[model samples]
Target chain A: MKKIFSILFVTLLLFSCQPDEIPPIGEATDYIPMLTGTWKLNKFEQIDADAESKSFPAFATVKDLTNVFPGHPYTDFSITFNPDGTFTADPGSSYMQMLTSGDWEVDDTEFPSAIILSSGSETQTIALNSLADVILGKVEFKEERKQADTGKIKIKYIYSLSKTSEL
Target chain B: MRQLIIISILIFGTFVLKAQDALPKFTVTPSEIDALTENVVIEFDVTGTAVEGLTDVYIWSWAPGLNPSEMLLCYDQGSPSWGSISDNAKLEPVAGQPNKFRLSLPKTVTRAGVEVTFNNVAELFGVGDTPGKIKEFGFLLRSQDGGSGGKQTPGDMKTSITLLPLEFEPSYFRTFPAKVSKNDVVTAYLNLSLIESSENQKLSVSDAFTATVSLLDENGTVLLTSEAFETTFTSEKEHAFSFIAEMLGAFPEGKSLDDVSKCQVVFSGKVYNQDESFETVSTKVFEFDFQDYE
Candidate 1:
């Protein structure tokens, strides 16, 4: 009886010390409520990348353009995401291809990793940047530009939006 | 001299007129290295370049480091200082091969009047943002003697300095060259960044750090000593002090540099006590037996 009790106690202790599985935080629809606000450009990065590495290319340097052009056009950039599936942007040359007003929808109302935008007949998809403040709703994404013939990525423009204001 | 020039030009003309496959390749062997102590071979084929058909070529090279504005001569102090580096830095033609030449570099080179190890070499070469992180090394090929006409490679030849990240792990105290002659301009390097935290804290509040050197005989008898001199702080965590052994006056005044065998160095700083009084603190004497490179 004593031997059996010791074995049972040890087994119970092992089960108690088992690792906890953390549940994924927030559903895809959570992004909609958190993103319904106007956000200003807080950080802008230009990554000069080496496009030759096959598996994982690297950037030579990441230059911070936050304060370089204090009164310049890009600093005044802002965007607003509304709850009605519409958005407005004042990119101000901050990006080569950006829309001022468009109807938008996220691919996953549950996971919400990419956003699709349409204006008239033109449409584009931009992925969410999970490296920075992605799921937390500060709203970050990067545009990687590639060479025309080679299709190899050469430069990256990373934007992290901050100073959010909700209606 | 005129005949030599005419023959060189003739050879150059013949090589240029021939059907060539491609532009010559200027390269460095073992371009990437594990340690700064490793030597690299700079090789080039002069098939179509301006300096084609030359018997010998001189190398004029400098790795950019310490100062961002200027290039530091890549040759070590033990090699040759600037202005007289031609013959000492010439590239030799590869045996049995027609147009190939190579210059094998020493592990350490003199820069800014100091013999520096490769860790310092990588920093000086402007390859990376910090010491021991080297990306590339570049060089220019030239003639042994400088004048109107000399053989030289076209444009700039660059080679990667390391295949893997050559990290410099600081041991707190180091002497450049690892070995030194009596008159060699010995440099002492002090890195306080990785010292014991408490000792590092004591040095942070000290007025200034100072160093002294003692020349000892083989039996370990101190023959001469130098006055304590303040070291130059090259960076927030790095300091350097350089001296030649023979320059100082001997103990009573006339022992030659050759009589001195072993060399010992000490670094000191002032530390404050609990009573608001300060006392002198010093490193235990670190010594190295001098080599007869002469």
Candidate 2:
């Protein structure tokens, strides 16, 4: 009985000494290092707010969106996340061809997680569906037109991004 | 004999006074306005004599396609005239008496300037939301209690107004080497011209301006970009400028310039104020093909 008890204690100690499983990129406690890089859009889709909800494909490539949506002024169609928590983004093509610079923060407390970006007086929060070292997926929230009788309409946009460069 | 002569003079003088009372002299303030303004407030003041028998106010505007002289003939004959004039030219009574009317010109008028004529007519045309240009405008005042149901009445007064012309059209674009050869160095040239403003004012060359050139692939991807070169208008002629881009340097690994099936040169100009706080002027995109330079 003493030998068996001693052997069981030794087995538990060995198991505890082994390294734990590594957490995913965005799920890790220290996730700031994983986000410092240039990212390009890969897919964009929108889910409508309706009883019978419908999913619509918005754009697949930079050129397709520019042609379909005239007056889109962005050319590079990319976002660069810097080590200092600053970010620069080309928000597609527009009449102004303006590039937006802002600050970003990751919120890991939520069920899925979220990334908040603030530019000037505008702030946008994107919910992360999945995150990895080279790929990131988020759901964008939008409010459509409101109906007096039916209340307010809302939509969800899914965005997938791929890492293009490291900083 | 002296009494008879005095009586004749008094009768003639009375007729002349009646004629003067029928006509109302008009004064339109701020005759000029910026070309891009959406709306303009024109104040109308009647001088000379008190206007009586005023009923309706009629306004007509003319642009490049519309003829003011012909429109006047239509009004005189009470015919459906101004075939070329768009319905966007509108008039409303804002201040003074209900008889004192205000003309609400459309945004199109400011972009291209128009001529407007105003008079008092029995019929009133409805206003419109469409955009249109007017070079001259005029108004007429008429009275309901006039001869032949106001048709033969000469009591209505008329006058004309002018709009400032646009300083420039969108933009004229051109490029060199409409085609491209592989591995060749690319050089781009751009030119812009300034036109007279609504105030008949010319744009100053000393104004701070920047010209930027961008090279985009068929996928609308920006492969290369030139610096925002600061330049000034040196001549009234096309403000000529140029920039160079290395074609081979823009290619990715395992690729060459030949892989670029299609490319475009986009040139734009913007004018800013002294402190760069205000961007007052900007040109539309001037996109052209970026051919390979042999």
Candidate 3:
């Protein structure tokens, strides 16, 4: 009985000495290397302040919220992130389509992380949920606007990007 | 030598023209004030040629640290002290006050720029209101259709003044059952206490005060939202009120309850006066991560 008691005490001491496991808040290390390269849109999710959820195809031609592609559906659409902190989106192979280019940066200080993209005077800050070498997921910040005729509305958007090429 | 002199003359002429064409210098007298009243008397002046073409001028006033969302919530609930702007008030010189004019803001102003400045300004707070102490006071000037080629300043043109010699007392809050386990039905409770600047003025509770809770997943998507709970303070001495938020059942879509990344709780409180007029006292947002729970 004395030996069993000693063993149990030692076991409790060892368990108490173990450090607490920290939940995966996503790796905070520099993501510039993993961020550079070509990526294709894989999934899109949008949720409004009212708790309404909407799912869209990889590249849809809808005009309401998922209108990344103006007139044409986003089939085989891809965005290339260069090493110099610049990015360009492929507007398909059509000549009439306009090319979209912007600047991108990652902010690791904020929880869920954030990636700010600026195209001209308009800028959008996207909250990163999970990020890896091959997979990237993000949720757009909430936007609130008041219509002159209607009242007020709040909207949020989320996106998933998959690595396509390293070059 | 002759060619050099000619070039010098042309350069000087161009420089003079540009100086004359620069945007007018706008000024606001008594730039800072110690106290705010229902009607604030403001002075405006234009010292350059651009003043003649000035179609309209407006003034925007508000307390610093108040965000746009909070201001809008206040406006929706009828609290006017967050900030406000004048609606294209006619800019005529003061009768006996010289450049000083009686300015009244139609609504609250949120952003800068002549066109964007007039929209979304909130009303001002006085001695009896919550957060009566002013830390940073902001004043802005705008001319209609104003720009480099027009009558107004080109960019974000505004001045911020610091109010001195004032004490501040913000609302205090506390929460219960600050932690929860996965797959457990939990009720989050919150307590909020009000503050009064003067002893003579009593703080009355409004029925519109509510508290709401939201559970978000790893993707910052809302997994569940609790119904907003209504609350009211019973007495002035015991100025604290409490509310409960209930989270029921397991999360949908077979997602593990432990995967919830964050929880947000928002408390919107309002107070009333002797005449039964109520205004939003405060709107506070609190965010908790999974680690905050036991």
Q: What is the DockQ of each candidate?
A: 0.01, 0.01, 0.02
- Chain A, candidate 2, TM-score of 0.54
* iRMS, all models: 19.6, 21.8, 20.6
Chain B TM-score (each prediction, in order): 0.41, 0.38, 0.32
The 10-residue segment with the lowest total lDDT in model 2 chain B:
B122-131
Q: Can you write out model 1's per-residue Cα lDDT over A8-50, one digit (the tens) per residue?
A: 9999999999999998786434566676778788886655443
Q: Candidate 3 at residue A42, lDDT?
A: 54
- Tell me the spans in candidate 1 whose CA falls farther than 4 Å from its real position: A1-29, A51-60, A67-71, A92-97, A131-137, B1-294
Angstrom error of the Cα, residue B46, model 2: value is 3.7
iRMS for model 1?
19.6
* Candidate 3 error regions (>4 Å): A1-27, A46-48, A51-71, A93-99, A109-112, A119-122, A127-153, B1-294
Q: Which whole-number lDDT from 0 to 100 does residue B82 have in model 3?
A: 22
Query: Sort by TM-score, best first: what order?
Result: 1, 2, 3
Q: Please write out the lDDT profile of model 3 over residues A30-118, one tens digit for every residue.
A: 56766778876554443322222112121111112233222433335567778898888785631112236899777653333666777
Which stretch of 10 consecutive residues in model 1 chain B shows the poorest summed lDDT? B65-74
State the displacement of the C-alpha of residue A33, model 2, in Å, after optimal TM-score superposition: 68
Model 2, B1-294: lDDT tens per residue? 999999999998887676555544444444554323444555433333333324344444323334333333224333435332323333354565653555543322211234433221101121111112334444444332234344211322235445454332222443222222322222233343434343112233324555665555667665655556544333333443433344123555554444454444443443456787553454555555543231
For all candidates in order, state the fraction of native interface contacts they contain.
0.00, 0.00, 0.00
As a whole number from 0 to 100, the lDDT of residue A24 in candidate 3 is 78
